[model samples]
Target: MFHSPRPLVAAAAVPIAFGRAGVLRRPQPRFNLVVDLTQQPFSKRWWRGLATLTALVAGVSQLAPPLGALPAGTPVAEGSDQARQEAALAVGALSQGSATGLTMSEGPLARPIVSAPARQSRSLSLIVSPGDDLARLLGRNGVRVADALQAAALVRAEKALPAPGTTLSLRLGAPDGAGQRPIEHLQYRARLDLELVISGSDAGLTVERRQLGLDRTPLRIRGSVGGGLYWALRSAGASPTQAADYLQAIGGSLDVGSEVMPGDRFELVVAQAKSADGRTLSGGLLYAGLERSGGSDLSLVRVPLGGKLQWISETASPEPVRSGLLTPVAGPITSGFGGRMHPILRFIRMHKGVDYGAGWGAPIVAAADGQVIRAGWTGGYGRQVRIAHEGGLVTSYSHMSRIVAEGGFVRRGELIGYVGSSGLSTGPHLHYEVLKDGVPVNPLGVTMVSRPLVDNRLMAAVRARAKALRGL
Candidate 1:
């Protein structure tokens, strides 16, 4: 669908075709065409068909024609009551010429057509974001408050909402004087987030917060505590140009899902390739730092290790050991495990596990190192996945955009699925549940145990380095 507010041609009686050169092509002549007119003294179909044939043969089907001309086609009926009637009408129409001041071969009837509005010549574009109040954003851009509200209302009616955190584009026209061009229009995608209470009443509100940020030379990326990670970073001002580049460089280098936490932090050195005319072409991560929620930090340096680019980490921490309970998605818990009424169907049922709020199709990560037990649709769960962790502990994820890899063993941080609101869900959320011995357990209550880097050799070196940094 086009995001711009360009003029659209109305549905025409004669369908128009196009060519490889983007030019509108004329319709091909309908060979062996037939017409019937016996039933009615002056039949509309007979005249219309005759006009079409003439127009097609003349190569000006779009133009109107006068009455009285020859009918060029014959009818070959294939046995039916309607066919017999059609044959009679065809014979009658052929015998009579100009009986109603209209002839078959004359041409199409002349009818006045409304002219299209003159198109304004200007550049156009659209920018969409999550949680941006369209009217307020437009108002800030100098549009009148009333006009902004009207525009937003129109867009909402158009159902142009993109998935949460996903950016939807609109055509932007060049500015005219102090305001945007009259042809300019903007739209915001629709997105919703859910919040759950750990210990609160139904009449109240509970809020949990998480934040991830880092400002280092050459690179800056911020992760959110509750919204879709990609969307949050984008909304917080991370450029798509840079984020996409970073994702491309480190795509398989790390599992962003399992490694991300509410307080996760990141910093990196990015190198940009530039043109002599001061245009930036591309860039990639050169060095980086990432810290998880439990204080596990990984330093990344891209260097020629064995004549190949390799990621080297210094000051390795053991807190991020493969526990296999980590999920690829990072954000706040939107829905919690419990029996409640269904959001859409209003059915009373049990919802197992907590759901992480995120954009539809957001990548889902393996919670821990485990082999997949199930990865397919389950009735009300839509696309579901079950993974078996250590000690007979199993985790389940439901309602996914897709199962990337399924029914296969995976490490603690491998990509397994994507976020979605399929099945009985009303919006995008990662429905995650943990079960032990076929009984559900509160995932949040289970503490994630990590093998701290407390090795004697590593500890001694770290202690010595700390002492040296302190000038001891």
Candidate 2:
């Protein structure tokens, strides 16, 4: 049977009392402090009690130890040493005394009893780049300026730094309290047969050079010119430098691409410096030779000539004679040199040069190697090119569509301008003229000049040096 529930007494409230454990306990009847739980608007006592509970909770939390730490005399569980060490590190507590270490007064690890952290040395491995010296590289890597200079100087006492692209190893000492590191050890290859080492010591830095015996001899490489001479030389143990040097020396006289046939035997001798284990450390081409089965053999050797080493061939042929005057272009002479009736002016006038009937924009070449005196606009010649040759002689190409040589040297047979009726008259044609001492001369029926012969003494000296290089 459900009887009517007893009504809650409005005056009944849970009173607060402080106990020995600093916790809330039941209050006695004599205690006047009490709270009315059923009241909507809290009285002064409710607010005061809420504030007092919050303050008590915060105080308890502040006084409790962190999770990473332990209470005093708490024996660490067995086999949990590693975990404890990690936790201690997380809280930044040292196992030994340090100026910056935290003081855990009541934890399992007491103040001044934490273990000290091991000091670690720093190291850096660097590759020597282009434009980098030893001292600059070390200082850039965080070594003290003074220490870097000292170590670099010590290394230089034995030998200078290695060339670029060398790998260097450096070990730095642990930084001091002032946060400065010193170079402890440095090592790098100084040369093909020598190594430089700088080791720091209590006295000072000591430099040591370790050297190995190397065989410095001329190496010979021979092969067949089946496909390409350069690639064949590379496959026969010649470095790229040697192969390129060989081509520049040999290809200038002979067109290796066309003249050098397949199955032709080729020989190369180069300067080499090798270690004991048959490893080539340095080499360069000294002699490049080619023997053809059905043609003249070519042999070039490096010899001292004109105060410097130069490549010269013993079986070199003399250069062919070249004509001084070459026709600028092949076309019909529409007009001849000397005076004639002016086609545009309709009067008798002095026609100074000959005219050639050429296609529109036809190329015009220099008659002889000379400097271009004028290349832009002229009085009635439209666009003109004037070249001053040897012996006070000058050649001019006028009435051009465009001018190419602006104010520099132009060689014979080199294009100077294109034919056009730019300035004076007519259609597409070139008015060519030659002047001796600034006076106009006839362009046609002029005597051609011949090339000179090579000196007999120069040729004899060249042959002698070539034989010396071949040890004949």
Candidate 3:
């Protein structure tokens, strides 16, 4: 029988049955009784206990080491070697402010060190000097002897070596273990329009010739004659060859030595040929003019006729012949063409020609258009050169430092030699002579004539070209 349940009490338990046999019974329900601590008189003591417990937990955490932190000498479990190592590393990092085998720094991270490789190639430039051949020049610039010789042989087989003052660009290989750097590549100008490139290694050498195109551009310049015509032209940006050509063109009418004075104004126009890379190749005078102080202005224009270029006057009037022979050198007459007391022999002798006193190496030019018949050393005349002109006329120049035109058809005012005292001479001077049929004669007494003008048809074209050039 189920008796009435006892009245619920503060600490009492209660249960209920389900089946008649009491096989299923309900569990006693638990009661969590919470009192109002704020209302209790001992509530302050309870809060104090909680505070103390929290303080104790915090103090223990502070005193114990971290999980991954252990002292170096601390013992560890046998199967926890890795864990022990990690703990030791952590402990070291904390103590030293950095991990083991690493330092804390305030800069970029260090990179791995590496060894530099050996140099394979280098570039160098060499200027050709006098008496310098390809082999010698390369040898002087640190090229291996055998390699230089082989390269020189290859270059000579393909083309002539570059002239003096020519710059050669070279690529050199690094020195081997034997301390030998070989020429790997060589480049130099073969001609004004051609360049030679040579490249090789230990295997063999290769040669290549490259052609350079030229561009012709017009140039005009004006200046006053100072010191001389050559100096004046050079001052106005004319090359030595151009200045000589200009003088030769006007030689038929103007005497450069005596007529050209200081302050003489001049103007010139030329077509200059330059390589694609801006190197000057050659130049040709298209027009030239000179205005003397008290004389009429002289103008010359280059005109094409009979497949050749000729310098003619702008006007139709026939070109005038030069009054006298062009002086060979710009020097005073030191000895006249007559008998004189021989300075060395101390005897009266017949001096065949006149002597012009000049410094050594002064340029001596042909007095008229002629062909060189003799150019070599003569006993008393020193280094002599004889040129045969038209109408059985011949001129001789002696005492030269060097002969420029040995045997060639030379025009009037052409450089033939430089003044020198090679043979019997007291000082540097030019002994000039004029001969008729191999007999010496007085040069100052004879007169020179100019050549005839071109055909009238050619002259018409020349006049037209001059007009167009002058913008008339």
Number of the top-ranking candidate, with lDDT as the measure: 3
Worst 10 residues of 2 by lDDT: 92-101
After superposition on all CA atoms, how large is the RMSD of candidate 1?
31.4
For TM-score, candidate 1 versus 3, the one ahead is 3
lDDT of each: 0.57, 0.73, 0.79
**Candidate 2 residue-wise lDDT, 1-472, digit = tens:** 9999998755457656789999978776653334454564476666766666678889999999886855675344346554455455553234432133233567566546455753567878899889887788888887878788898777666656668888888888877665667777888877778878888766767888888688877777888877778788888878888776776566544545456788888887777788775656656667778888868887876666546555656664456433445566546789888779988988988888889889998667777667899998897899999998777888888888898788876655566778888876769898999888888889775543433223466567766755554552
Please say which candidate is ahead in lDDT: 1 or 3.
3
Q: Write the per-residue lDDT of candidate 3 for residues 1-472, one digit (tens) a residue.
A: 8999987765335455578886877664443233344554456655665566678889999999878955676444356555445555765334434234433345578554465466788898889888878888787777888888988897788766788899899998888766668777889997788899888766767888898897766677789998888888998888887787788777645677777789899877777778877787556878777889967777778876545565777654666454567789889999998999999889999999999999998889889878899999999888999999877989999989999999977767777889999899999999999998889999998787666556678677777766665552
Q: Locate the minimum summed-lDDT window of 10 residues in model 3.
A: 95-104
Error of 1 at 406 (Å): 1.9
> Which residue segments of model 2 deviate by more than 4 Å?
1-116, 119-124, 131-133, 139-142, 155-159, 179-181, 277-279, 315-472
lDDT of 1 by residue, 1-472 (tens): 7687887766686688889999998886675356654544356767776786777877863455756687777544466654546544554344432122222343477544565343343332335456777666555655444455655665556454344454433333444455543324333323222111111123321222222222222434444434444554566555675554344333334556544566566554555443333434334556545555765555545544444454434554556554335545766787677887777778987876887898877777766656798988898889999988667788888899899768866645456878998888788888888999889987776544444324556445544533332231
Deviation (Å) of 171 in candidate 1: 44
> 1 or 2: which has the higher TM-score?
2
Q: Model 1, poorest ten-residue lDDT window?
A: 191-200
TM-score of each: 0.37, 0.45, 0.57
Report model 1's TM-score to 2 decimal places.
0.37
